[model samples]
Target: MSGSDGSGPAGRDHPFDAAVALKPADTGDGTYTGATHPAYANMVGPYGGITAATLLEAVQCHPERLGVPVSLTVNYAGPVADGEFTVSARPSRTNRSTQHWSLELTQDGRVITTATAVYAARRDTWADTEATMPDVPEPEAVPVTPMPDEVQWAKNYEMRFLDGALPALEGAPESPDSTTMLWVRDAPARPLDFPALASLCDVFYPRVFLRRGQAMPAGTISLTVYFHADEAVLADHGTRPVLARARSNRFGRSYFDQSACLWGTGGELLATTHQLVYFKG
Candidate 1:
């Protein structure tokens, strides 16, 4: 019997893998088919981070893919139903040191998501990190916060907040600012990689909800991530938890923008991400 998590009974696929599962069939036109997994389901749709990672996965799986992904941007045009979808990935431009790709995810002939990516061949060069990791207790020192059921995606990872948390709905006042720091990684200890890191970037709860002490309808409209480390750097960290810092600069007119950074335990910067979110008060 099939399970709601999109795997057969006795599910063995890792949650991270299941969340990004995509199959390549003979699409004659070089497109691939994908489906949303229940393991990463949100209140109304698949987590935006998972959807973004899946689109990047399509570009990664394309036979013509060049180099390693350096940057990715995903646009959510509409809701993605819990079923099969199609992804089309094509190389838009290629250069000696850089490559560009364009991609789309569609269901029922309706375009629901779009993305663009840039990949680059790495070469030895001068490097520096300007952003310092937050001075907080190590992951092992912090206790895992209880996961609430409504946000199904929260169960897939272990999150220990060092700074910000959702305010109580009953009598708590609004938060001082929309800033948060947390350590997060896959629950069952999956290796850190591009797709996994991509999903982690969006794992933070909507900043508005955290700041206002209210549950409002909120969703990410677009997200962009810039990778600062290579595969070797990520592999060195294994399944170790990464520290994340997210903050919103402005919230107005039904939209807000968020900026975040992910850091390896060794003080290495992994990636920086930004997003624009839509919210209804």
Candidate 2:
């Protein structure tokens, strides 16, 4: 689904995907607006940024740079209820090492949020280091997990809960801190390039970390993922697992920070992430 209003005045599909609308004029003033859905807001992260990135990559000197997302910064300027949403973007600057894109997501005449992203310019340097993969559980061997809540975004990837998953929805442990692990693979049915892989990798924030108590819900407002390497730990599409470990840093009313590790089955550190979030009940 894209972003647009709930009304099905014309062509429509997923209600939450409606709010987002795109201006193709490249008026140097390109824009995308989307509708919002209550269910999609909590379920999906920010599709506008994602769609914008995908659009930005189209014109980039680089051919379809959709692999890993090195960093993503999002500002939640206002409430974004589900309906139809739109995103717009253009090249902010260009260079060899990295490319920058300025993007915005809006609904109707109003702006829902804004985003910025950075992508690697050359062949990945991280993969140069040689290391053994982790010896985690066989991804398929582990029990399959059903998606959570009516969260539509969760369906974007294939997830296998290693531990601390089923109980997460009820709120975290009674203590102050905790950790959870999951084996995740994205777009499993379809082959994904490096950039899209990184984007999806960073997409699951907020709920990525394990926490204690119900006093407040601290989730990521911004996240950065550094891909150390691109070695495939899992060759079979049937099942593949990447270890996702979550831990919190400082906690506050307005914001907090946390870190996560995404590892290969061979226990190799594939990617590292740090997130800043809005924390409050």
Candidate 3:
């Protein structure tokens, strides 16, 4: 939603916030309605990140939401047509400390996306991060990576690449592996939040682009994000850039797997995400 409600960075109009704005539906079935934002549109549909964030927002705004999201898994069932869509988030189960939710997005009468989320009331506990942020130059030290203008969603994020940038669209040397490390944040600098963090989990380009050094048909089939930071951590993070690292495990005949991690400025593990991708050469 627009930061006008005090949910975003002050005095700045951010398209990312607009892209994720959702309103409760009048159907009285605990559903929400939202329209696609042109600024976040992808080559074929809305950016997968925006869609994921929108789904998470659906849960975050639910009246019965128990707590902050700890885990979210969204499955892309089909292409989302450009237009208005409805989302339904229903609590499937609730425990003393955790809650499970089932979510769906529909356009017209067809299901475009499906998801599951887990929210929990966290308690102070001992925690440590085994995965550390890679040693990279400061965000200011690295120059901005120019994004393809055709990809509308890419314009919403400021990205500075340290390694494994997208290869030439045509012939290019293949890389030994698909590992990308970069610093990214909202283009206009928005405060860190659950929806923003969810969207950041998907900022990486398709692994195939880095591996093959050429663009190919690729799309995420399903994505899962594990939140490690809480509201306090995000509030402390504010509008600073975050370090993001991602790599692919296997590229089979038609599918591949991507694993990624987002680290705060102080090397705190913000979130970990994994996704299955479909590709065609």
Predicted structure with the largest TM-score when compared to the true one: 3
Better of 2 and 3 by lDDT: 3
Give the local distance difference test score of model 3. Answer: 0.90
lDDT (C-alpha) at residue 71 in model 3: 99
- Model 2 ranges off by over 4 Å: 1-69, 123-135, 166-176, 194-199, 202-210, 213-219, 227-239, 264-270
lDDT of 3 by residue, 41-148 (tens): 887788898999999999888888897999999999988888899999999999999999999999997999999999999998897889988888889999998788
lDDT per residue (tens digit) for residues 82-174 in model 1: 989998888899999999998899999899999999999999889788998978898999988855777788888899888786556557678
Error of 3 at 85 (Å): 0.4
TM-score to true structure, per model: 0.94, 0.65, 0.95
Badly placed stretches (over 4 Å) of model 3 are 1-12
Question: Residue 62's C-alpha lDDT in candidate 2?
Answer: 31
Residue 72 lDDT, candidate 1, scale 0-100: 95
